[model samples]
Target: MGGGRWTVVLDPHRWLELRRFRGLYESGAMSLREIAKETGLNRRTVAKYLSGRTPSAPPERAASDRPRRRVVDEVAPLIDAMLRAEILLKGAVIHERLVAEYGFTINYQRVKMYLQEARPRIAEELGISPGELAGLHRRFEVVPGAQAQVDWGDEGKILAHVGIPKVYSFHMTLSYSRDPFCCFTTSQDLATFFDCHRQAFAHFGGVPMSIVYDRTKTVVRRHVAPGEAVPLHPEAVAFAGHYDFDPDVLAAYRPTGKGRVERQVLIVRDHVLAGRAFSSIEEMNAAFTAWVPLRRAKVHGTHGEVIGLRAVRDHTALRPLPQSPYVVAQRHLRYVGKDCLVAFDANLYSVPAFRVRPRQLVEVRATKSQITLHATTPGAGGETLLAAHSRAVGRGARVVDERHWDGLPTGAGRRVTAGGDLPAPLQQRAQDSSSGSLMALLNRAAATQVEVGRRPLSVYDELTGTRPFTTHPNTKETP
Candidate 1:
């Protein structure tokens, strides 16, 4: 209302009022000046409202002519490159790489905002659908006993009070029935892993046609890139071969591939382990074993059938187990030390001295409860069992068999014998030497003997190097 033009901001309420006044003016019921006077507003403002043009509609502000600046614009190409390289790269990782490798000074929030717009566009260009990138996987069903999914659950420190540092749960679920079998173990080593598989197979009474598993080191020899042929562990291959089942190694980071067992891992924790204190892995396994009947009694949510009934079908369709289960062992090459001992698992086991030489290479085949040492070279007795010992429970223990040290010197002018006694010749020689020494001692002590009725006390005293005490006759006591 000053000399210069000023802007009039029209809120919705004020705009509605102006529209109502315009309606009245259109009807010729009120003059513009009269409406302005009644509304306590300026005449020109009311006239503008009454004009054919819609004055209630705010005037569009002219767009700014200055160029816009965005901090992320400079790094757009770098971000695109990263997205192209790894479609699932996180915005935080991109921001970190930008700051570290590309000298980007922008903060993480800005990078995250840019990713919100850029990720989908890049994914589309790369022909990856949004649903796929968002972890959408189709549900699948397998025929009874056709497949099983395996996964591991890490139960950290759950049994630490029982001296176990860590505990792991091994889960195997029949894909069709969703019947789960889980056991608790302290190790994921090759032997223990396959041993658990054996236990599961026994529990089910048969093996599936194929088993789906993650790229665990116990199953896979090493991790290969996507689409590459996965190199399986030698023991794993042998196990599968023996069981007549194929091992289906899942893609990296794809838990959905083994979703049945992955879900079973959680289900078991909720049903069996939650709020329960277990003293040992066996007790934990026993808890799962007890829960299995309850689990099988209920109708499965996905399959819509009693789990036990479905499992019956699955067990029927499975391949019959072999007469004897495959012996799963982790094999390693170790050199026998000069002491005729082979080192394994931080413990030393004796090898027969006649069977193995010092510095000889031997194959150590270890299972959960036993260690078997074998001679490696043909000249040294090809693949012969050198020694077998129970596995040491703790580290740094030396497990030796006295028979293994028979040929070695005893450092007492004799050699260790098989029966843990001196040899006949050595025994005779020892007896003769002892008898001669006793006779020479007696001959020397004869000069110190006194002529008494029996072996005199003076002779004994002189030989034993002690002074005999004497008492006076006048005293009442004798010594």
Candidate 2:
């Protein structure tokens, strides 16, 4: 017995005897000697336990209850501050920063253990549950085709020469199957947004009944009161109408509502973009396409079913696409410049000469590779297509149709090559009209001023005799 504390492993028989003895003693049917003899423990040990004077807890717990002293204890306040600053930072990162900046000499495990105790306090100070404050997310599943999640990820600068261009990936994932489709673009504009949707639907073979979206301006026009229905952008409403899908917007500041897509975005960045270099957007998308099939073939973590097999079930419940594919073009009102050209995407497309007047308001519909200019009001038929040009990919490009400018005239008054040229006789007249008209007019004026004129002012003055006397202002006229 080391210092009267015998740490012995009692057999089951000894435990049974202890309980029986304790029960008999409690009932006042056994003496201390008898109980001790029956239990085989010393009389003192039995008295220690029965008197409620045993060690307050197990020996190990007593040793563990004392606060652990560590090198980090010297900067306990700093650790608390780090926790307050960013609760999500792991102990390894905190330790790294402390060592690098504060010269902390401590192991990572000690910091990790300390953080476990400090986090709940920090969370309490912020008036939130530790779980909520720590962003503990719950997993959710929806019926196949019932919902899909859409989001955009900033991919940093890729095609820098094309413009220090920031690329973004548009990701849409079916919630049930975890099947994801991604497209990369240089913009997040409404046109690009809808274009990605079209591409995603084509890739998936159909559209989900509803698409979950964060409060992006492309979907929600503006923020509204809590619990109120968010107002959808007009273009978005039209797009949803065309696709026959409901737009489900997540509450502001809640990203976990669409965690599947969020997770898939990280998955793509890790598996596709990480440590990979691509010079073009097309290459990135092609890589994604090739990788998608392999990803689908693997068993998903949440569903425990092969993603591709699950997707087969997902596709059956999806809404069918409309007969004619939705025309996803951006329409902008453009002014026809005096050059008989309409400016679009930094390119010029000529309208038929005399067909559209300069400064005329025209609607320019731009698809990925085509630009179509239309008159605001329909002609005798329907919307008049004044011009259509293959969309130029480069800036300052000119897509001119020489036939469109046929009605325009050449330099001076010569008509261009009913090619808007003046008549042959009219050209001859125009050629001579400038100099000939001026010379003929001058000769007529000279003839009119000839000295043999029938009635001159001087002749009339002489005939009258009195008016010829000194009419100059400097000479005084006699009254």
1-479 per-residue lDDT for model 1 (tens digits): 32432355656644554556665678776678766654455677667657864543542222468543455678999889878876767675577567655787875655776787899999999999544334577799889989998888998999999788989998999999998999988888888888889999999999999999988899899988788999999989999999999999988888888888888887787667754578988899888887787788878888799999999999999999999989889999999899999999899999999877778899999998899998775553345788899989868999999999897888888554333444477556656884455333334443244343567678888998877686566887835
**Against the true structure, candidate 1 has what lDDT?**
0.79
Q: Per-residue lDDT of 197-221 in model 2, one digit per residue for the tens? A: 9999999999999999999998888
**Model 2, poorest ten-residue lDDT window?**
54-63
lDDT of 1 at 395: 82
What candidate 2 gets wrong by more than 4 Å, as runs, is: 1-134, 161-164, 412-479
Q: What is the lDDT of candidate 2?
A: 0.77
lDDT of 2 at 325: 66
Cα displacement (angstroms), candidate 1, residue 443, comes to 16
lDDT of 2 at 58: 21
Best by TM-score: 1
